[model samples]
Target: DQQVKQNSPSLSVQEGRISILNCDYTNSMFDYFLWYKKYPAEGPTFLISISSIKDKNEDGRFTVFLNKSAKHLSLHIVPSQPGDSAVYFCAARGYTGKLIFGQGTTLQVKP
Candidate 1:
């Protein structure tokens, strides 16, 4: 039962504002966490990731935090821009290289 859940199906934010996306998992064996941004009809691209041993990871305007104890994680984008509007997927490696992904969160950044 590998289930990654993104409670919000969508989110909207104005440009230059902060955007936050949340994800939760029920599986305790997942050790790697990854966030991917996807555009229509295209494959998802890796944005940020954090290992189970770490608490936080950041790159540029994107940051991801993981809480192993709570089985929860979140992604934050500071000063989000219009280009940041996309479907964000939180995934975790399961039994193999296959990843378990949430339904996805559509972030609409208003111009």
Candidate 2:
């Protein structure tokens, strides 16, 4: 079974708006959650993360929320820009440092 999943295949947003991306997971063992941004022909780069003990984390325009009881998580990007267009991936890391990723969501920021 896929431990993590992104239900939306893609999202489109106008520049300077807020873009929301969501994710769900089946495994409670995952203690660390992270979001990554990927461009074509390149590897995914870390965007933001939250620990299991924390409910929310933020960094500049990126924020991540974790709901352990609901087994769900989401990423928010404020003032979305054309440069933000990319595949967003949600990932969870367990005790072993092994990461499980959700199916990516492609974000198209139209300027």
- Which candidate gets the maximum lDDT versus the true structure? 2
lDDT of 2 by residue, 1-111 (tens): 999999999999999999999999999999999999999999999999999999999999999999999999999999899999999999999998899999999999999
Which residue pairs collide in model 2, if any? Answer: none
**After best superposition, candidate 1 residue 30: deviation in angstroms?**
0.6
Name the runs in model 2 displaced over 4 angstroms.
Answer: none
> Among these predicted structures, which one has the highest TM-score?
2
Q: Write model 1 residue lDDT over 1-111, tens digit each, in one string.
A: 548999999999999999999999998778799999999999999999999889999999999999988999999999899999999999987656668999899999999
**Per-residue lDDT of 78 in model 1:** 99
Global lDDT of each model? 0.93, 0.97
Q: RMSD for all candidates, in order, please.
A: 1.3, 0.6
